[model samples]
Target: MMKRKILVLKYSFLAILLILLNTFNVNGQDEFVKKSFTTADPLYTNLLKATEGNFKNYPHSFLENGNIKYYQIDEWTGGFWPGSLWYMYEYTKEEKWKKAATAWTNSLESNQYNTKHHDIGFMMYCSYGNALKFDDNPKYKEILIQSAKSLTQRYSPVVGSIQSWNTRKSKGDINLWEYAVIMDNMMNLELLFYASKVTNDPVYKNIAINHAAKTMQNHLRADYSSYHVVNYDPKSGKVLHKQTLQGFSDESTWARGQAWGIYGFTTVYRETKDKRFLKTAVKMANFFLDHPNLPKDKIPYWDFNVGQPGFKPDWDFDPKRFKETPRDASAAAITSSALLELSTYVKGKQKQKFYNAALAMLKSLSSDTYLNTNNANPYYLLKHSTGNLPSNREIDVPLIYADYYFLEALTRYEKSK
Candidate 1:
């Protein structure tokens, strides 16, 4: 009789423990969602107030000297503002956010035909892509198809890659590059893949596959760390240069560029179901996550090797001026969103690792250290993003794209739960 009583007590205790754990988990997610909105609602509300319905002047970044910088509709980051608005509409189902997102998304219609740059995907997909998720407008699909067509105009049959930047002299007369492809260009291929799916044409998908294959071969190192720019001979498809235009040196890894690789390749794997792309994405993700220089908070410095021995760049900045290197919240945000999607593709411990890492990054980003609670930068969301640090531009400021990805990560986190 005493043994039976003991077993009953043990089982009761186990049941209570499980209940408590489940309740705590649910409450934790609720708290995160509550906090996210509490911070974002005011900042985005202020953004709309400041703009006063001006769709042409997209919010880009908050400058160091206390000014809200705006980018034209044609800029690389033009879509992020609208993308964030779309996320807001998705979360709240509020008409104001939807109306604002529609107007801002409509402002960038001209970018569908922009063939001069390789960032049309970033400028179009991020906005219209998210818009279509809520409303399946045929116009949105047609616009995206046209954007993909324009992007294909920059592809080289010989190089098997999309040209990132046109031939131009550097600071000096450095025209050694006939064709340049940056790691960031991996992101633009999604538009082409989407176009192929909608149009039932393999031409766009074939171009994207060729570009991904060539990039996998030439742009990534043995450790999967990527070069910022890989220059190719236009006529022969020969890799002319594998160097850095935005990192600490020719050899150092740029944090945002690495984040772009993780996000881009994961996206490719999603669209293609190619195991090679999945393997590459996993390797690149591990490289970023396992790097010793990655801070405890998961937000990384502008360059992974910054201030370390033998990693100096020939830029004009004074290293001594900054007591600690600047962190790129944008990198963390982008990686967090990518990891959430990647977690769905894997199972067991790998899935848990990615999911937990993404949560940690989101936690750090939502904290007071990174979240813009005081409206110091009224036009932007998160702070301490490094954009083009070597060129002395947009350092340690609030960037629009950082906010877009942060909101996106939060949305993905909620859905995964």
Candidate 2:
């Protein structure tokens, strides 16, 4: 009888231990969610307020020529202002941000028909896309569809790509763009894809697919780095020349161009669920991540191959004289957001690696080294972004899009966790 009683006490102790472990697991999970999701970054609000104040004066792109300024509706960066406001609203659920976003977005209504360049996506979708994502407003849908249609006017069936620019002759007596397609054009494809979804039309989707496929075939090097522009014969679709308009050289990888490629392809994969795009994105990301020139913080120089030996590229000024070349925070912000999205679609070590790299970039960008906390420049969030280094324009300055993508990365991080 005594032995039986001892056995019952042993089973009771085991049951109690199991209950305690289950409780501990639940509490651990709750702690993780509370720490990651519920905690908001105070910087977001501070930067947004700063931007609001600056917008009251400038009402457009961030600082230019050491002064606050605005841009035309067709400017490549015009949509970023509204897009950033949308992101602010997305993060905070604040109505003031939404009102500002709507006002800025409406200011771009004329841009729906502007076909002067391939940046209509950046102008329209970045602003309206987020609005539609949350509000499902029919007006945003109509504007985006019209913008996509306008973009389709630039596609060339013969070249299987979208034309980026018209012909131009440089002082060196070199003529460009009988048919020019740029790496930056890849970013515009998203608007077309989204239009296809909303309109139930395959034409827009097909154009984007053909352009992507052709670009994959002709623009990328074996190492997965991309050319900034590829020119072709308009009539016969014959390849004419591959060149770098913004990069250090025809052989170099422009950091922002590379970032655009990764983000573009990752987005394509998300829209289509095509494994080929995912594979391509992975390859391109590997090239960027593994390159020796990549900084320890993961923010890259303006052009990856610029400072290397044996290459001389034309720039408006000499890059070699600078003690250290400027880093592109815009590229880092775009890449970090793309990497966070890419991590969700991948598995195993690759997934963890992408996530960790994105987290590191966020940490670096959030630091005083990059983050613009000083009220000195309330119009911008992060500083030291490079734009058109070859042309001696906006180098090491804060760009509107940089702030947009930084907020975007933060929002994505909150959701991803």
TM-score of each: 0.96, 0.86
Candidate 1 to native Cα RMSD, angstroms: 1.6
User: Model 1, stretches more than 4 Å misplaced?
Assistant: 1-10, 171-175
Regions of model 2 farther than 4 Å from truth: 1-66, 315-317
Note each model's CA RMSD in angstroms: 1.6, 5.0
Model 2 weakest 10-residue run by lDDT: 32-41
- Top candidate by lDDT: 1
All candidates' lDDT scores? 0.90, 0.81
Clashes of 1: 0
TM-score of 1: 0.96
- Model 1 agreement with the true structure over 314-387: per-residue lDDT tens digits: 66758887878999999999999999999899889989989999999998998888988777776666889999
